[model samples]
Target chain A: MQKTTSSISNNISFTRGVPALEALPTTLFSECLQAVLAGPDGKTVLQYGHNGGYVPLKQLLAEQYHVDVDQVLIGNGSLHLQDMLTAQLVQTGDVVFTEQPSYDRAIKTFRRRGAKVIGIPLALDGVDITALEEALARYTPRFMYIVPDFQNPAGVTTSREKRQALAQLAEKHGFYLVEDVPYRTLRYSGKTLPLLRELNPERTITVSSYSKLISPGIRVGYLIGPRDIVKPLIALAEDTTLAPVLPTQAAVLEFHKRGYFERNLESLKQLYAPRLQAMISAIKTYLPGIDFAEPEGGFFVSITLPQESNYQHLLQRAKEQGLLLTDGNGFFADHLNAQANQAHTGDRFVRLPFCALTPQEIEAGMQRLAELVRA
Target chain B: MQKTTSSISNNISFTRGVPALEALPTTLFSECLQAVLAGPDGKTVLQYGHNGGYVPLKQLLAEQYHVDVDQVLIGNGSLHLQDMLTAQLVQTGDVVFTEQPSYDRAIKTFRRRGAKVIGIPLALDGVDITALEEALARYTPRFMYIVPDFQNPAGVTTSREKRQALAQLAEKHGFYLVEDVPYRTLRYSGKTLPLLRELNPERTITVSSYSKLISPGIRVGYLIGPRDIVKPLIALAEDTTLAPVLPTQAAVLEFHKRGYFERNLESLKQLYAPRLQAMISAIKTYLPGIDFAEPEGGFFVSITLPQESNYQHLLQRAKEQGLLLTDGNGFFADHLNAQANQAHTGDRFVRLPFCALTPQEIEAGMQRLAELVRA
Candidate 1:
C-alpha cells in the first residue's frame, strides 16, 4: 500500500498527516539547531543522552504540561512511546480498546504486539460511552487508547462530559486510559476541555509529540504517567533507542527557551485555520450530499458518502484525477476482518486532511473529489 | 544501577563508550546541518520521513557497504535496530545465544523480551567455537547475537577464519547470526576482515551504527540483511519509532555529500589512537600484574585481575580514588542469575574505555586504578 502511494506522482496528497511544508519554520529551526551546536553543551549533545531524555527539555515539557519533572519520559516520537507502552502493558492476546476509526499507525503497533484490539464506535462528540462501557465490561482491556482532542481520522474532539466519564470509568474499572493528545495544542477554535490526566491523574497516561506541533522530522515526544509505570518504561526506552536524538532535543529546548515555540505554534494556527475552513467550505459547496462534522482543528476532515455511493470506486476515480486521499475503510479495524455492519459503514467514509494542503489545493482537490463522487 | 553510576562525580569516567567531545568536528557538522536546512529539500527534512529512512542516506550507506539500498534499513540507532530485530524474530521464552561478556544493554533488551540468554565464553579471537557448537547442539536459538568487531567490554575482534566459521555454522545449523558491528568503522589499526554478511548473506543480519563513528546523539544506524527478514523489521520499525529522526538524517546526508564524514572519521581515528596507546602504556607501567589483550581498535581494554583479587573491592577503592570504570560482571548474562563458573570468572574482569577521555586522563585514571588494584 505504501509502495503504491509512493509510485503516484504529481498528485496533491491529502492522505498524509504531516504539517504543510510551506508552513514549517525551517529557517528558525535551523537557527535554533545552529545555536545548540555552538553552545557550551555542544559536545554533550553529540554523546549518548539520558534514556529518559535531555533534562532541560524534560523540565520545559514538565512546565508546559503542568506535571512534575519525573512524570515525563522522552521518546523518538509519540509512536515510539505508544510502542513502549504497548510492550510494557500488553502481552500477546491481551485485549486493548481503541476508537473504531483511530490513528491507523497506532492500531498497527497494537496489532503488531499481538494485542487483540476491540474498536468501539465513536460518537460525533467522542467515543460512544455506552459501547465503551460494554466493551470494558466484556474484555477488561489492558488500556483504552483515545485521542480526545481532534481525534485523528474522525476529527471529532471528545466532549467534556465524555472525557470525565471515560476518566472515571478508567479509575472505576482499574484500567489505564492512554490519552494521546498530539493534536491538542492545534486548536484553531473552541474552548479547551480538561485533560484526562487532570480528571484522573493516577489512571491516565498522556502521550504527546513535537511532531505535529514543532517538526515531525525531529522525532521528539514525551509520555507523562504514574511513576511506577514510567520507571519501567525508562528502562525499556534505554533498551529501545537508548535515548532520543540529543542534538534535536537540544535544538527544540533552545527553540522553546528563546520563546519561539509559542510564537511558531500561533503562526501555524494562522496558517492552518483558513486551509481547514477552505476544506469545510469546499466540501459544502461541491459535495452537497456528503456528511461531515466541521473540525475546529487538527489534520483531518472525514466525509461519509451516501449509502448507495461506492467509496472505493470513487477513490480510484479521484486518484485518476491526481488527488490522493485516505480511504476510511483502512481506518477501521473491523473492516480488515470484514465484520458486517462496521465494514459496511466504513465503505461510506473517506478522510481528507486539510493540514498538509494549501487552501487553493484543498478547494481544487475537493472539487476533483466531488466530480468523481457525482460521476 | 544507573542511579548509582550517575551519583558518582568528579571522577575520570572510563566506563562510557562514547567518543571524545574534544575531537568531534562540531563546526563542520554545524555547517553541514545548516547547509541541509538551507537546501531546497529543507521542508522535506522537517516532515515525516520514510519508515526505512531518508533514501539518499540509505544510498550512501549502500554504496559504502556494497549492498543494495533495499537491504539497508535505518533506525534511531543500533540499539533501536536491535529492538526491532528482536521483536521481529524472538518470541517469549525463546533461547538466544550471546558472548559471555556481551554489551550489557543488548542483553537487557533480550532478557526484557523474555528470551532466555545463554552465554558462550569468548576466546581471544572471538566466541569459542567449541562452546558455540555445543550450545547450538543443546538449543536452537532464535539468533546468535555477536559483536564481532571489537566486542564491547572485551575489545576483541573476530579473526577472518572465525568469522567464516561462525557464518558457516549459522547456515549449517539453520539459525540466524545477528552481527552487531557498531565499532567496525573505528579501526585505528588492523587489516579489515570479511564481514559476517559477506561470508553468509542468507543467514546473517549485520547491524551497525554511526553512533561510534560520527555522533551518538544523532542516533542513526542501519541493518543490512536479506529482504524477507528486513521487510518485517521495517514494519516493526514503523510501529516502533515510525522512522529515524529526519533532520539528523538530512544533516548526515549533507555531511557525507560534502565529504566531511570521511575527514571527520580520520580525525576521530587520529584522536583516539594515541589515547588507546597511552592507556596500554599506562597499564604496563603502573598495573604490572594485571592481564589484558591489547586491542587494535575500538573503545575498551578489558583487564582481568589475578585469581585471588577481589575485583569488586578494588573497583570501590578505585572509585574512592576518583576513577570510574565498568564492572565486567555486568556484561556477563550469567552474573545476573548467579550462575556459577561464568559468574565467578566475570567477577575478575573490568572494562576501561579509552575513547571518551584524553591521553592524559587515561594515563592518570589507569595509574589510580593500578594503585587501588595494588592495595
Candidate 2:
C-alpha cells in the first residue's frame, strides 16, 4: 500500500515553480564552470571574495542595469537579498505592503521579521490603486514589495499605467518600492512594461536572480539600488555570510561572457510556452467552474473555484488521485493570520505552475482535478 | 599620492582568516565539479534542491558525526546558519552571551538582532567559567555563542573540563549553546577536544563549515542540532534562500566521495602550521612587551598591547607604514556598545590571522608592528 501510494504521488506535480528539466542547460553550465576555473583569475575566484560579490559579475550587472558597480550587490540568491532587506528595514510593529495574493514565502518572511503585512487587492492590470492609496494614506509602510512582471501565484503583470502610479505614489509617500523581477525575462508572450525601478530609480530597489534564466543550482542573484541602501546590505552580507559564493558567480559570469545567456532564455521561453498553453486548454476543458485570467508568461496560472466549492476537500482528493497542487490559502497575508487565529479564508483559490511539467502530465493532472471537482 | 597610498595598503594584510591561495585545491575542485555534473544525478543537481540541503552531503556528515540525517541542516555558510539561529530564537531585548572578544561579526549580528549581549571574560583556556556563571546567575540568555576550538580573534581553545561545565550549565539554566566550529577542523596542532554537542546533544547546536576545510568560496556550512531547532532553520531557509546552493554542495560531496577531503585537510595543515609558527616566533622575538596566549592551531594569534599604548594612533601609523592590522575594539560587544555611548574599551587587544599570509610575510608584518610598538 505504501509503495503504491508513493508511486501514485509521483504521477504529476504542479506545485513547483522551477524550470522544467529540459529547460536547464546542464552541459552548458558544466562548460561554463570549466571555463571559469581555467581562467587566469582562477586563484582569485577560489579565494574569499569581496562582500559586494565577484567584482566582474557586479560590473556586468551594473552595465546591463545602467547603474554604478557600487549599486549592485550580488547575493546567494534574490530570496536571500529579500531576507537581508527585511532585516535591514523591518522592525517589530513596522508595516509592509504586498499584493493580496502574493508569493507565499515572501509574505512569510515579512511576517517572520515582525512586519504587519498589509495586502493590497490585485486586479487583472495590477494592484488596485484605490485600495493601495487608502492603505498608504492610513499607514506608511517601510517598503512596498511588487513582483511587477509575471507576478507569482497570480500570474498577473502590472500594467505600465499601474507602474507609473506606483512610482509616483512611492515618491510622494516617501516609502521604498522593492521591485522584484525574477520572472521578467520568462515572458512567453505580451509586451514588456517599464520596470518600477526604471520609472522611479531613486526610490526603487530591483531584485532579480539567475534561478530561472540560468540554472537554479547556480544560485546567483543580485539587487540593484541606491548606493546608500546597497552599502548596509553589503555590511549585512559581510557579518552574515562573509561573501556570496564566488565559484558559482564566476561560472555565471563566464556563461554571460560566452554569450549563452540570451540564447538560454530564448530556449526556456520556447520550452515553457507550450506547457502554459496546455494548462490553459486543460483548465478550459476540465475546469469549467474555475475562473482565471489567462497569463501570457511566467510559470503560474491561478484560479478561483466556484463559490460553493470546498477547496480543502478538493485538495485532499486531488492528492489521493496523485495530482500535486500548491494550496491557495498560503498566498494571502490576512488568510495566514486568520489561519493562526483558527479561521480560514482564500481556500477556493489555487495556483497551477506549468513550467516544471510536460503538457501530457498537465492534461492528466487537470483531468484528475476535474473528476474530483465533479465528485 | 593616492596611488602610493593604495600600494602601501596592499603591502601586508593580517585582517583576513581565509586559507592561503596555495592551499586551495583549485584543480581538484574543478575536477570534482565536472565529475558531479557528469554523474547520473546531474539533472537533479541543477534543479531546485530540497530545503535541507544536498542529501548525500548530509548523509555523509551524518555518518561522520554519528547523528541521524534529519539532525543535520546544511546552510549557505556557517555564518548564515548562525544568522538563522539568532532570527529563530532571539527577540528584541533578549539576552545573548558571548566571549568578551568573540568573532566581531557575530557580535554585530547578535546586536543587530536587538539582543542585549553580555560578554563573558576569556582566559587562555576558554571563556572564564566564573564570569559565565555570574552572568547566568543574573540573566537567562536565549543562547550562548561559543567558538570552542581555537576561538576566532582569541585563538584560545576551551578545555574539555570547561566544555563539560558548559554542558552542565546549559542544562541547568535551560539555555541553548550555539557551538560554532569554523576553525575546529583547521587545527595545526594540539589534541582534538570533545565538541559541546557531543557532551550535551539535547541543548547544543553545532555549526561548522567547509570554508576553511575545503574552500571559502564554496560557501558550504551546516548545523547539527535537535530536530525541533533544525526543522525551523530549514523552514527559515526555505522561506528565505529557497535552498542552499546545490552545485557547490554537490562538488563538496563529490570531493568527499573521491576521498580527497582528508588529504586536502592534511595539506592545509602543512601549509598553515609553519605560518603559525613564524607568527609566534616573531611575536616572541620582536614584540616582547606584548602579552599573548600562543595558540597551537587555527588562523589567529591575539595579542594584548601594553597599557600605555594608544592603539588608535598605532593603527593609523601602521596603515601609513604599509602594515595592516585588524582593529581590536570591534571584537568586544561591551566595547561596541560603549562606543555608541561615547566611550571606548578593549582597544589594547589585536587579532592577527596567520593562515592567509606566508612565513616571510608574517615575519615582515611582525617586524613592522615591532617597529611601531617601539616608536
Candidate 3:
C-alpha cells in the first residue's frame, strides 16, 4: 500500500475494555476546542497546565458545591480521581467495598491497586444497607466506594435514607466513603439525594466531572473531600495528567457560568431520553425475557438475559453486526482471579448505552441484537 | 460565600492545575472541534481509537525513531503512561533511579507506589554516567528514567556516547530503560544524540507527546516499546484514563495528516528561539552569581543559585512583582528523604522557562528575579 500519512507505526493490539465511541457526544469535537479558543486570553488552553484545576472552572465548580476553594481537586475525569483516591486510600489485601455491579471501572481501579473489593448488592433505592452493614461488620473495608447518583453498570439510584445510612456506616466503621458521582446532575425525575459528602462532610470524598454534564473529551472533573484526602489526590493529579485539559475546563466553566450548562444538559436529555426509550422498547418487543432496570437518567441500562443464554457470545456477535456493548464480566473486581471468577461469575448481564446514539440507531442496534438472539 | 449554582459544592482548598490553553495552536483547535461535531458513524474514526497509539501519529513518531509499529503503546500523555508503566513494572521496594534533580512530579508518582528511588547526579552530557553506573551496580533500579532530549528541570541532553553506554548498561544489567523524550523535538540549536530507544531496541521504552508540538489540552501522547510490554501498558491504560481523549486524538490526527505539525513546529521555532536567547541574556546580565548550563534547546534552564539563597522567598517576591518560577525542590523523587537532599537540594536550582514567555516578559521576569535575589 502507498505510504499514506495515516501510519499506525506500532502494532497496537486492542484492549478488551475500550467502549464503543459511536455514541459519544458529537458536538464535543468542537466544544472542547472552541471553549479554549474563546477563553479570556484566547490561548489554546493546552500548555503545561496548572497543577490545580482550571482557575475559573474550579471557581465555577466551587460555586456549585457551596464549598470552600480548598475542598475540591479536579482531575482528568472522575476516572482519574477514582484511581488516585483508591491508590492513596487502599493498600494491598486491604478490604474495600463498592455497590455490586457498580461502576466496574472503579472496581478495576481499586482491584488493580491490590485492594480486595467487596460488592454490596444494589437495591431499588440504593445499595443494600443491610449488605453494607454486613460488609462493614465482617470485612471492615478501608473505604467504601459508591456512585450514589444513577450509578454505572447497575444504573440504580440510592435513596436519601440509604445514602444517609451509608454515610453513618462510614462514620461508625471509621472507613471513608469514596463517592463517584459523575451522574449527579442527570436526574430525569424525583428529588436528588444529597451527596454522601453533603450528608456527612467528614466521611465522604465526592468525585464528579464535566464528562456527563458537558463533554468527556475535555476530560475535566473534580474530587471533593476533606483536606487530608485531597492532598494525596492532588499529588496523584500532579503525577497523572498534571491537571485536566485546561481548554475544556475554561470553556466548561465559561459555559456553566453563562447559563449554558442548562441548555446543553437540556439538549442532552432531549437527545438521550428518546434513545433510552427506544432501546427499552426494542428490548420489550424483541426479547421480553431479558430482565433490566431502566435508569432514572444516565448513559446505560443493565440487562439480565435468560440464564440459558450466553451473553458473552452474544456480545461478540453484537459487535460483529456493528453494535457495541460493555460486557458484564470485566466489571468484577476479582475477574482476574480464577476462584473469584468461579464464585462470582455470571454471563446473563450486559450494559447498553444510548447516550451517543440517536433513538433510531438504538432501535436498530437493539433489533439486530434481537435477531441474533432469536437465531 | 454565596450558595451559587456556578461553583463546586465543597470548599475545596487545592488549586486547579493550569489549563492547556496558554500554549496550544489555535487553527488546529478549531479543526479538531469540527471533527467532533461530526457524529460517530459505523465506519467513523470514533468507533474506538487505536489501543496503543493513534495510527498516523504513532507512525510519524516511529519513523522518526526508525522503529517498527510493534514497539509503541499510546496513551493519555507521557504523564499517564509514566504512572501506568511504573505501576506495572515497579513494586514495593523496587529501586527507581532518576536524575539527581529530575521531574519531581514523576518522582513523587513512583514513590506513591512505594518505589525506592536513587537519584544520580546530572551533568552537561546528561546523567553522570560514572555515578549512574555506580548506582546501577548498587541499586539495580527496576527502570532508569531519563529525559534524553531537553529534560524537564535541567534542560540537558545526554551525549551520544553516554546514550549508547546507558543503553548497553541496561542490557548488561537486565533492566528496562525509559527515555522520556517529550522535549526531543523542541530544539533551539544544539545537537541531540540518538534517543535511548534507538540505542537499545529491546530494553528501551520511548515516551513522547504533542504537548510540546501542538497542545497539552488535547492530552494526547504515546509510549513506544516491545509489544509484550505494550500489552500490559494498554491493560493499565484500561484502568487509567480509559483512553486518550478521542476528539483530541482525531483533531491531532487530522492536523498531522494535513501537515499541520510540520508547519506549526517551524513556526514555533520562530516564536521560541528569540525568547530563549532573551532569557539566557537576561540571566547573564541580572543574576550574575547564579550560573547554569545554557540549554541548547527546549523550554527550561536549571539555574543554580547559592545554597544559602531562599528560592521560595525569592519566588514570592517575584510573584509580587509579577513573575513566577517553579521551585527547584519539586524535581526530587526523595524530597522526604534527607539524603536525596544532598543532590542540589534547596534554594540551589530553579527551572526557568522562556518558551511560553515573550522576550519582554522573559526580560521582565528575569529582572524581577535579579532584584529579589540581590535584595
Candidate 4:
C-alpha cells in the first residue's frame, strides 16, 4: 500500500484539511515578519519567551475573546494544547468522550495518554444527546472534546439548543468541556451561536488557533480557561518546550494588528465557499442518494457508503484513479466496555476535504469516486 | 519578595541563561524570512509540515552529523524532545539520574513525570564517575541526562576520558544516555571533544537546539538517534502539534544555507567570551578563596558558599542591592531512596550565567555580591 501510494503521481488529494495554497497571504506574512523584526520588541521576539506564550499575542487574544490576560494560554498549535490537557487530566483506565467520527489525531492523543475513548454518535445538528446522557450515567469522563462549530470530518455544527443542553450536562456531570472552535470564523452561511465557554464558564475550556484564520505555519493556538487549569498547563509547557515559538507569534500579532486577519479571512471565505458549493453539487450530481449532511462551512464533507461497500477497496480504487480520499475508520473510536472489538464503526464512510481543492477538481474527484462505488 | 523584586526599576542579575540581545542577528533573520517566503517552497512553508521536521533542515543536520536523514527529528525546542523522551520512557516509580546541579527545568520535568531523580555529584572535570558507578550498580536508570559540553548551572565540561568511560558504562549497564549539547559550538577555548553519540551512537540520544546558536524564538531543535526512538517521537509530535513551525523552520534552513549561522556563532562567541572572562576574573579578585571552577566555555560559573552562610539570606540581601539571582536549591534533585528530604544539597551554591550580561555589569554584580557577603 505504501509503495503503491508513493508511486502515484499527479494525484488530487482530499486527505488534507488545510487552506488552499492560493489562499495563503505570502506577501502579508513577509511584511509582518519584516515589521516585527524592525519593531520595538524585536529583540524580545528573538529571545526565550514567557512559558505560556508570547505576551503581546496573549494580550491580543485576551481582548478579542473578552477574557483576562491571565486566563489565556497560548501553545504551538491547538492540538498541542489538547495533548497537554489530555496528559494533565487523563491517566491509565480513565474514560474520555468524543464525537463519533471525531478528529483522529485527538483520539490517538487521548489513547496515547492511556485513556479509554468512547465516541458517541453524532446527529446532523450535534452529538447525540441521548447517547451522551447514557454514557454519562455509566462513566465519569475526565473531559469531553468537541469541535462545536463545523466539526472536523463529520462536518456537523451543534445547534443553539443542543449547545445549551450540553453545557448543562457538563455542569451536572462535573466534567470539563474542551470546546474546540478552529472553524468558528469560517462560516459561510450559518448564523454564529454562543461559545460553549460563554454558556458554562466554570466547566469549559475554549481552544482556538490562528491556523485556520491567519496561517497554520505560524503555529499559534490558545486556550482560554480557568487559572487552575491554565497554570498547571503553563508549568507543563515550560517543562516541555520552555515557550512557544515567539518569532512567528510576533509575526501573527503584527498581522492581527495590521487588520490583515479580517481581510485574509474574507478572501479565504470567497475562495472556499464556491468550492464547498461545488463539492455538494457534485455529490448530488455524481453520487446521488449518498447520505451526508451539507456543511454550512468548514473543509470537509463525509459520506456514508452502503453497508456492503468496503472503504479500503474504494480508497485503493480511488488512488488508482489518481483521486485520494481519507479512510473513515481512523475517525471512529473503540468502545470502553465492549468485550469484542468494534472494527466496523467508521469503515463504511469516506471524508472529502473541499478547502484545498478547486471546484473543478472537487467535481472530477467526486466523479471518479462515483465510478468506483458503482463498480 | 515578589513585591520588592517587582518594585525595583534597575537590576543587574545573572539569572537568565540566554544570548545577549546585541548578539541577535535581527537583520539576517529578516532577510532569511523574506527569502524563505519568496523561495520556491514558499507555499509549503505556510502549510502544515512533516511531523519529523522541515525536510531540508533535517537533511542539513543529518549531513552535518553524518547520519541518515531519518535519524534526525526536529522539535519545538531540544527540551521538547527531552520531555517527550522522559514521558515515553520514565513511568511512575522509574529511576532517572542527573548531575547534582542540573538544568532546573529538566529536573522538574523528570520529577513531574513521576520519576525518582538521583543526583550524581559532579567533580571539576565532569560528573563524579565513582558516584555514577555506585548509583548504576544499585539502580538501573531509564537514562542518565547530561549537558556534556557546557553543563547548565555548573558550566562543567566533561573530559575526553570521562566521556569515553561514561559511554562504556552505558553500554555495560544497558542504560541510555541523553547528551544535551546546547552550548557545544560556543567554545571560547579548549579543543572540542567527541559527542557522546559519536562515542556510543547505540546508547546515546543526542539533543541539540538552535536556541543558542541561531535564536530561541524560532524554537527549532533536533534529535539524532536510532530509528526506533526517532519513529515513536515523530508519532508523538504528530499527535501533539501536527508539525513543528514550518515558517520558522524554513527561515532557519535559509539561514543555514546562506551561511549566516557560522557568522552569527562567531559574533555570539565574541559577545559572550569577554563576559565569561570577566565573571571568572571578578570571582578571583572580589571573592578571593571562593571554591569554584573556571569553565573553558559556556554560560555559567557557580561558586559554593561557606557552610555557615544561608543562601536565602544572601538572595534577600542581593535583591535589596538591586540584583536578581536564581535560587540554587531548585537545581538539585531530591533523592528517590532517601528517607528525609535533601534540603541543603544545592543551598550552598549559586550559579552565575555570563551570556546575558556585559563585562562591566559582570564586574559590578560581583562587587555587589562581595560587599553583601562581607556585610
Candidate 5:
C-alpha cells in the first residue's frame, strides 16, 4: 500500500531504507511453533507470558554474559525500553549526549520528549568521550545513550579504557547509562569483550534482542537496570503493550533451549564475515575519497563522504542501476543545517548496508555506486 | 541463574510468569525465519519492517475484515498503539471516556498521558450510552476506549445500533474514537455484529491482535484508521519496535493463507465454548449476589460482586488455593481514587478469564470463587 506522509516522512524512507526481512531462523521458528502447538493451546498464548522474556532465552543470555539474571528485563524491544528510559529520566530540555551522527530514531525520541541533544563527533573509536566527560561535568546529562558494540552507521566499538572510563564517569556522576547492544551477538570478529553491564550493572541499562540473531518480526528485545528504575519502565510497559505475546516467547524459549540460537549465530557469522570483508575491500578499491570505519563485528559500516545535497538523487541513480542505499540525511538528528544549506552539497554521505547483500551483490552494488559517483 | 527480587524469599519461583516459549507456533515461524536466513540478514531485521506490520499479515487481516489494505496500521499490540495514539492526540488534562471498569492497561495509558479520564458505567450491552452521551455533551473528550465483543473485565460488546450511534456521535462531536477490539474475533457466540470502523473509519482507531486468536507472545496487533492519522502512527511505529518479528509474521501469514486461521478459531470455540458456559453457569448458580455479564465469546466474563471489599481481600485466599486473579483495582483510568485517599475501591468487581481451563476446571474454579464470596 502507498503510505502518504507529512514533514516526518522526509526523515524516513520505508520503501528504500528498510531492507527485506533477511536471514531469519524460519526452520527453528517453525520447529518451535510445532512444539508449542503439540502441547496445549489454552495456557500458551491466552494466559500472561513472562514479565521478562522466555526463561531459557534469559538464562542463555545470562550464561553468555556471565551475569546474574536480575540484571535483565526483556521488553517488546530495545526501543520500547528506550522509550521507558527516556520517560523516567529525561526531563524536557535535559541534555542527552550522543554521537553527532547516531541512530536518528534515538535522536528523534529524545527530541520528541523535549531533550536538548548534545552531539559529539563519531570518532574511529566511538563518540568523543572528551566531549562526553565535559558534558557530564557541565550539562549533567540525564543519561548518555550509545550503541557501544558495532554502533549504527559509525560501526565503531569503544576502546576498553573508554568503557572503563565511561563507567567510572557514570559512577561519579549520578546519571544512568543506557548501553544498547542490539548488534553485540552478531559478531563477525572472533574476539569479544565484557559488556558494559559486566563492569557495572547498577547504573547501566543494557538492552539487546533476538531480532538480529533470530528474527526481528517477533518484536523481541530486553533491558536490564536498577529495580526502582525498571519498575517505572515495567509500569510504562504495562501501559503500552500490557505484555509481550506469550506464544512467540514460548517459541523463542524452545528455539534457545533446543540449541537453535548458538548454531544459527555461527551460521550467520560465517555467512556475514565475507560480505563485510567484501564491502571493506571494495570501499578501499573504489570509493577512495570517503573515510569510514569497517566494524570488526555487526551489520553496519560508516563513511564520511564530501558533503553534498540531494541524497535522494544519488539514491534514485543507484536504484535505477538495481542497487539500494540509505540517504545519510535520513540519519541526522537535525535536518536543517544553515551550514548544510548548499544544494547538491548539503547531503554529505549515505549508509551502504553490505551485510544485507551477498559478496556478489555487494560488489555489484558498490560498482553501480562507483559509476554513480563518477557520473 | 537465580534472579534476585525484593519479593524474592530464599525460596525461588523464578518460573512463575515465564512463558513456555516452546508453546508458540515454531513450524510456521521457521518458514518465515528460513526466508530471513539463507537470504539477506540485514534486510531481514535491520532494514525497516512495515509500520503497520508484515504486509502479508496485514493483507490477511484485510481479507478477514473485507476491507482495503490501507485501513490497517499494525502495532506491537493494542497497548502499544494506545501509547502512540495518546502521544499523538492527547495533551495534559484532556478528557477521555472509557468504561467505568475496563481494561486497566488502557486506563493507565491515557492517565499517563495526563488525560482527565471520565469512566462511564459498563454493562453486558456495552458501556452505558446515556452516561457516555452526557459526558460527551459536558466535556471535550479526545477519544473513547471500548472493547465491543467479549471485552476485558466486563466481557461486553456494543450492539450494532450502539456502534453506529457511537460513530455518529463521534462525527457530530469531532472527537476521535479509539476502538480496541483484540478480543473481537474471540467471541464465544456464533454471531457478532458490525464494528465502529464500519460506521466511521476516518474517526476510528481499530486495534486487534493475534494474541488471543493465534498467540500473545508473538506480540502482534494492528490499528486501522485514516491515512492522515495512520501515517504519523507509522512514523511513530518506526521508533518503536521497528517492526514486528518476521518469523511470527511469516508463520501467521502462512496460517492465514493455508486456511489454518479459521480452523484454529473454530476448534477453539468448540473447545472453550463449553468451558465458558460451565464457568458462567457455576458463577450464577453458586454465587447468589454477584452481578456479571455472560459473555457470548472470548476468554473472559466480567463479574461485579455484591457490595463489599471482601472480593478484594479474597485474592490471597484464592492464591492459597492455587488460583490467581486480577482485581477491579487494575481496570480503572486512575488506579487511585483521588476522591478517597486510598487505592480505588471500585474494588467490588473482578474479571474472570475462562478460556484457559477445561469445563471441569472451570466448574472447580467457579466453585472455589463461590465459596470465597459466600465466606
Candidate 6:
C-alpha cells in the first residue's frame, strides 16, 4: 500500500483524532513531570514498574472508574491493551464481531491476529441488535468489539437498551464483550449512561485511554475487567513491553492528584464545543445535499455523499484545495471475512474530525470540501 | 504461578537490572523534557507521532547506527520491539532458538507467540557455535534470538569471531539473526565488536534499548533491519501501540542533542566498574568454592553453586538475611522444546546484579549470600 498525505504548503487536516495542539497543557505537564521527578516516589517513577502498572495510578483509576485496583491493567496505550487482549484470547481463525465501519486500526489489529472479523450493520442508536443476536447465535464469536461511546467514523452512541441487550447476549452465548470507550467522558450534549463493563461485570472488558482527555504523547491507557480475565493480560503485558513507561504513568497520577485532570477536561470541553458547532454550521451552509448526523461529542462527523459521487475522487480533489479528510473505505473490512456483504457501505462516506482544527479552519475546510463535491 | 519478591527490612537487592536510583540523571532528564516542551517541536512532541517513531528521532538513530532511516523502527521498549518482530515473523508451532540461559522475559515473549523455543548451550565466549550449527542443521528455525553484548544473566559478551560466524550461519541457513544489544554501550573494559546487523545486513535484525543507558522509565528502544523486515514491524507497531510515547521520544532526541547521553555513559561506567570489582572481590573473599567467570562489564555476575546444593533453600535463607538475588532457574526455558536437556543447566546458577546497589551493600549482600550457600 502507498502512503497518502494531503499537505500543500499549509493544509487544514480534518483527518486527525488528536486534541488541539495549541490548547495542549504543555506547561502544566512539564510542571507535573518536574514535581514527579523531585517527589518522594522519584526512584519508583524512574525505575522499571510492576508488570500490571504503577500501583498508585491503578488505584486512582480504580477509584475514578468504580472498580477494584486488581481489575485495572495500564498499558502503553489503549490500542496496546486491545492488542494484548487479542493476543491472549484469540486463536487463529477465531470468529470476532465488530460494528460496520468501526475503527479502522482496531479492525486491522483483529484481522492481524488471524481473526475472521464479521461486521454487524449499525442502526440509528447503535449496532443492530437483531443482527448482533443472529451473528452471536450462528458464529459463536470469541468476542464482540464495540465502540459504545461516540463510535468512531460514525459518531453514533449505543442506546441504554441496546447496551443492556448486548451484555445479556454475550452472557447467553458464552462470549466476551469488549467495549472501547475512549470518548466516554466527552459528552457535550447528552446524558452519560452506565458503561458496558458495569452492566456485565462478569463477561465485559472495558478499554479506555487518557489520550483524548489529556495528551496523546504520554501514551497511557487502561483496561478494566474481571480479575480472571485481567490476570492473563497482565502476563501478556509483561511479555509485551515489560511495563508501561513509568514516568508517564507517574506524571498522569500527579496530574490527577493535583486535580488538573478534571479541571483540564472541563477546559477541553469548552475549547472543542465551539469548533464542533462551527463544523455543523458550515456543513449546513455549504453542503446542503450531503447526509450526516450532528455529533453530540467526540472528534468525528461522518458524511455520506450521493451514490454516484466518488469519495476517492472527492478526497483527492479536496486535498488539492488544502482540505484533508479520511475516505471511509479505510474504516471497513476488506471482504476477506464472513461479513463480506457488509463491507461496502463506506464507499461514499468520509470521516471529518473537528477537535484538531480551529473553528475558522473547519469552516474554510468544509467550504472547500463542498466545492469539491459540487465539481 | 506465585509472585516473587526480594525484600525485607534493610534489604539490599542484587536482583534488579535497573540503574542505581540515586545516580540517575534525573536533573538532566527534567531539563531536557522542559526544553522539548518549550522548543519549536513542543506541539509536535505532545501530539500523536508516526507509527514507526518520531521522524527526526529515527533519522538521528539511523545516522548513529549507520543504517537507512527506513530500516529503523522504534517501539515502547526493546521487549516491545522483540514481541512485534515475533508477531511479524513466527507462526504457531514455528521453531525458534535462544541461548541456554537467556533473558527470561524474552523467552516468555517468544513462547507467548506459540513458537517452540530451543536453547543452545553457552560456552565461555558465547553460545556454542558447534551446537548452534547442529541445531540449525536439524531444524529450520524461524529466528535465533541472542544477547551478544554482555549477555544477561551470564555476563558473557560474544567473541568477535563467534559474532561473525553466527551472522554467516544465519545467512547460510536462510534464517534471521535477532541480536539484542541492550548493554552494548555499557562496556567498561572490553573492546567493542561490530554489530551483527552490520556484518549481515540482509539477514540480521538488531534490537537495542536506551533503558540501560538512559533510564527505564522513558521506555524508548529501536530495531534495525532491512526495509522489508522493518516495514511489517512498523505496521505492527501501529497496531500494537499506535506509536511510542511521543514526548519520551522527543525528550530522548533532546538529550542526545544536548550531549548528555554520551557523557552520562562515561559517568555510569565510572560508577559501575568499582561496584563490579567489589562484588567480585566479595565473592572471592567470602565464598571459596563457587565457580564464576569474572565479567568485563554489564550488571550481572552469575555464580554456579555446588551440584548437591538446593538453590531454592539458599534463596529462602538469603531472603531471611535481607539479601536479594535472582535464581538462575528463572532464565531457562521450561523444557517444552527440542533442547529439553539444556534447560536444566540453569538449576545450579544464580545471578547477582552489581549495578543497582552500592559497593558497601554489594559487599554485605554477598557476605550474607555466601553464608546461606555454606549453610
Give the true-contact fraction for every prediction, in order: 0.86, 0.79, 0.57, 0.85, 0.49, 0.76
Instruction: Report the Cα lDDT for residue A245, model 5.
Output: 61
Tens digit of lDDT per residue, candidate 3, span A1-375? Answer: 122212322212111322234334455435544655755544636665664677666676678788776778876677777887877887789998877776777877888878988777666567778766766677788888887776776667778888889888888889898888777677766677788888888988888877667655556768888888886667667666664566556766666656767877777666667766877787787678655666777766666666455455866776666656666666555444313433234355566766666555555666666666663
lDDT of each: 0.82, 0.84, 0.69, 0.84, 0.67, 0.82
lDDT of 3: 0.69
Give candidate 6's whole-model lDDT.
0.82
Q: What is the lDDT of residue A139 in candidate 6?
A: 93
What interface-residue Cα RMSD does candidate 4 give after superposition?
Answer: 0.9
Quote the lDDT for A365 in model 1.
Answer: 77
Per-residue CA lDDT of model 6 for B1-375, tens digit only, reads: 111223223888878688887667888888888898888888787788885988889999999889899999988889889987998899999999998788988998898888998888776688889988888878988999888887888887888999899888988889998999988888889688898888898989999988888888788999999899998889778767886788888888988999998989999999999999998898888777666767788888877777565565666777777877676676876454323553245656778888988887787777677667663
> Could you give the interface RMSD of each candidate, to one decimal?
1.2, 1.0, 4.2, 0.9, 5.5, 1.1
Q: Which candidate is the best by TM-score?
A: 4
What RMSD value applies to candidate 5? 7.5
lDDT of 1 by residue, B1-375 (tens): 012323434689877788787776677778878898899878888888885998888888889878888888998888778877887788889999888788888898888777999888887788889878887888988899998888898888888888988988988888899999888878889787888988988999999888887788888888999989988888778767876688888788888888888898898888889988998898788777665668888888887777655465766777777887676667887665334654236667778898888777777776666656663
